[model samples]
Target: MAFDNFYYCVLYEKKYSDYFLYQCILLWMCRKTKSSVTEQQPDSSAIHTISTLPDTNQYLYDFLKMVLADQKLQYSYGLSQEVKNCLYVESDEVYLSRFIITPPQTNPYDQNPSGVDSTKLIYNTDSSVSVNISAQLILNTLTLLPNHACLKKSDITYMMAEKSRLHNLKWNNQKTGFSLTNKNNWYTFSLPYFSKDKKKAFICIQSLCPGLCGSGDVLLYQFKNNKWTSQKVDSWLH
Candidate 1:
């Protein structure tokens, strides 16, 4: 029998008086509404989403490999070969604000003690090397990246995964190495922001491991004679 009908019949019985009948009606309505709602709702876990990464940019990979191969970057981590091989590159590109700087504009209301020109923007954090790319263009691209950009697995030659995977590793007694069973440590690189002429590139690379093992720096690379050479523009270590 329908619950509503059952309640109606109970309410008709004189012995099944006021409060009991009212409670039964309320309980039946709640049960019916709950069941109907459950049947109508979708199973969120069953729904899957496929996120597509950006196209493979040869220069981006080239720059990454070049920096990774740097002797300083390799040995500075103080990790053994086993742990170094476990270094996984992040699948999404990032921009490190601490390393890239926009020089103060020449607006009259703004501080202009040095009289820096607004047009002279896009400098390295130390304000020593000024890149040829428009400051606004780079800023807009970097700002939009959180919502729109990602690196594809095929775009990288190294092992690539999300940074969160670092938590899966089992640290060794010294914390400088991971146990043989652990999957990886992690490193990240900013997209290679190139000069308009494509001959100059600026990038930031960060290496992170469990505990105090880490190093990071922003570098400026100049392409010349069909080869790329880099200079440190900013640095951090631990």
Candidate 2:
């Protein structure tokens, strides 16, 4: 006698022997249902397994490496070498990582340096989400073009006059000076002294005109393959 459904069980329940068989079948069905439910349920440990944040210093180091590897900026700045001995990590907030780049000491015996470079990390609080890393050149007196003999006032004036002509603008003859000033004048200088290799040079112009036209610009000229090729970098001044 086969009991496939509840109706079958009821129909078969007649004699004592049949009643005993139906009772056994009900017990088996109950056990099978319990087993199936248990199999479908997820394990609590597996579901609640916790993830953690990466080591801060290591993460920032990796980030800096990637930034230095950028083809365009690396060719001009050589950030990889500059940052090798100077990278540091700290927390600005619970969710933000700060990478600080300290300048190399001027003197071997000096224990402290005055300049500091910093970049902030922006990321989601959720561990499962991706993180965004970014950095920028922090301009300062140390980062600016250093004084060079080639950056004479007369040379600056000629360069500015040529640049003005190309742009269909007038060169501010009165504003030509070595030091940066607030007046709407032209300040031209060369930073050949800053290049460790001595084969690259930077020329900067600061113009404070009456309107938005007044701004600072830099040009990087690298002596490569027996010729000088010029590249424009982002302005150090706003």
Candidate 3:
């Protein structure tokens, strides 16, 4: 579901290189479309999806090992590992998430992207963290991080709409579907009765390019009755 009717352009942030600051802008704007707001009937027409994640999966901790490959290297030295420290998720919930199959894109020989290649940064009322991933599957690619891993206040966490005046990236309330005064993300989605909102209850993987395999991360949050909650966990997968 691509938009032939799409708007594309560039912005000069002056503070950072065009690629550094604008990558998020590009993702936010050209982000892929969702399956039809209405679902196709599973029928004589055979409307259904059977999903699976690749065996070479690298949840955040596995990614950390890759980043700090040398025995002497510490996790803090790796940019992505540092990013993961900020996003906090439940250990039991860390598993590959399957996504609807979309056409594959032309990746270069040097660019063996694995999962979600986009970086996900989570923000709360008083804290923020970022989840960086490297997955090949459309969905089985993201994980969570903790607030302590957020590192700097100026890191590429909260993205500002290219032309917005406010610092926050305002989005709607996933639960009520109403306009939310507060901005949030972590790829809000659902599971039965759970609201795996980015504000510590959801996760996603967006990229999987090799070297730094284009990656993605899920910023899950726990919002009860409109108030965000806090939590934590630690581990890895490969």
Candidate 4:
């Protein structure tokens, strides 16, 4: 309910009906008060002194972090609850920023990307994903790409996706090899070991990518003679 309140606040803001909003908040507060009293055993004064007035969204989230610092919060964890609610509000705001209001776009390729020496996890011997992370030079954007010509025959870096569901990898870890395949009709990175018959690994170039443009292909370097043969393998990527 608290999270719902945050979402409503961010998305509708001035549009929300005052009565409806107040009711929702009042209901949420009642639920929280009951839960805190039973679980935390706080004195009656703690409950009575607490205020339900709306506050700055960021403050709500920060307050949550402080409450969570301690292991216990069964009674009055308003600060912690508010922080979680803040995150939810932020996510909603981002989604709205992208979908409902599409602003003028920036050319992601124009910016300087992560370091050339930086290496990222492309696959982890698993089948769920294959990605390259960059960030030798931090940009305002989460990800970036280099130019197409650079992508044609160069290496690039991209900041890995932030911590998330459906995402796995030790964040900012050095380059770990990866593979991608359609397993059970689902695209997956990381191939099983000892499956010599399967595509083993996936690689990418992040030179000109503005974050992760998904340009270029996997690294398919094979040595036939004294010379090395490097091929672009994006299609071969998942």
Residue 73 in model 1: shift from native, Å? 5.1
Q: State the lDDT of candidate 1 residue by residue for 1-238, as single tens digits.
A: 6999988887687556766889999999999999999989876654432234443344445555666676244433433332222111332233322223345444453334543434446457767544343223222234522221122323221213322333233323242222433324555455455544566665666677788877877666777899888777557787
Which residue pairs clash in candidate 2?
184-208
Number of the top TM-score candidate: 1
Residue-level lDDT of model 4, residues 1-238, one tens digit each, is: 9999998888786566776889899999999999988987867777666764453233323322332232122221111101111112234224112212134465444344443332344455564443444433344665343211211111111111111221332211112111122121211112111112212212222222123332222333333455333444333221
lDDT by residue (1-238, candidate 3, tens digit) is: 1343232222233445767658887676555332332344355334332334432322323332322242223222112211122222532222212211235455332233453455547676777766655554344334453332321221122211111222232322331232233222222211211222222233332322234334344433355687644332222332
Clashes of 3: 46
TM of each candidate vs. truth? 0.32, 0.22, 0.16, 0.16
* Least accurate 10 contiguous residues by lDDT in model 1: 144-153
Pairwise lDDT winner, candidates 1 and 2: 1
User: How many collisions per candidate?
Assistant: 0, 1, 46, 37
Q: Which candidate number maximizes lDDT?
A: 1
- Quantify all predictions' global Cα lDDT against the true fold: 0.50, 0.39, 0.31, 0.32
Which regions in candidate 4 have their CA more than 4 angstroms from the true location? Answer: 1-167, 171-201, 208-214, 223-228, 234-238
> Deviation in angstroms for 60 in model 1?
1.3
For model 2, the superposed segments whose C-alpha errors exceed 4 Å read 1-14, 50-235
TM-score of 2: 0.22
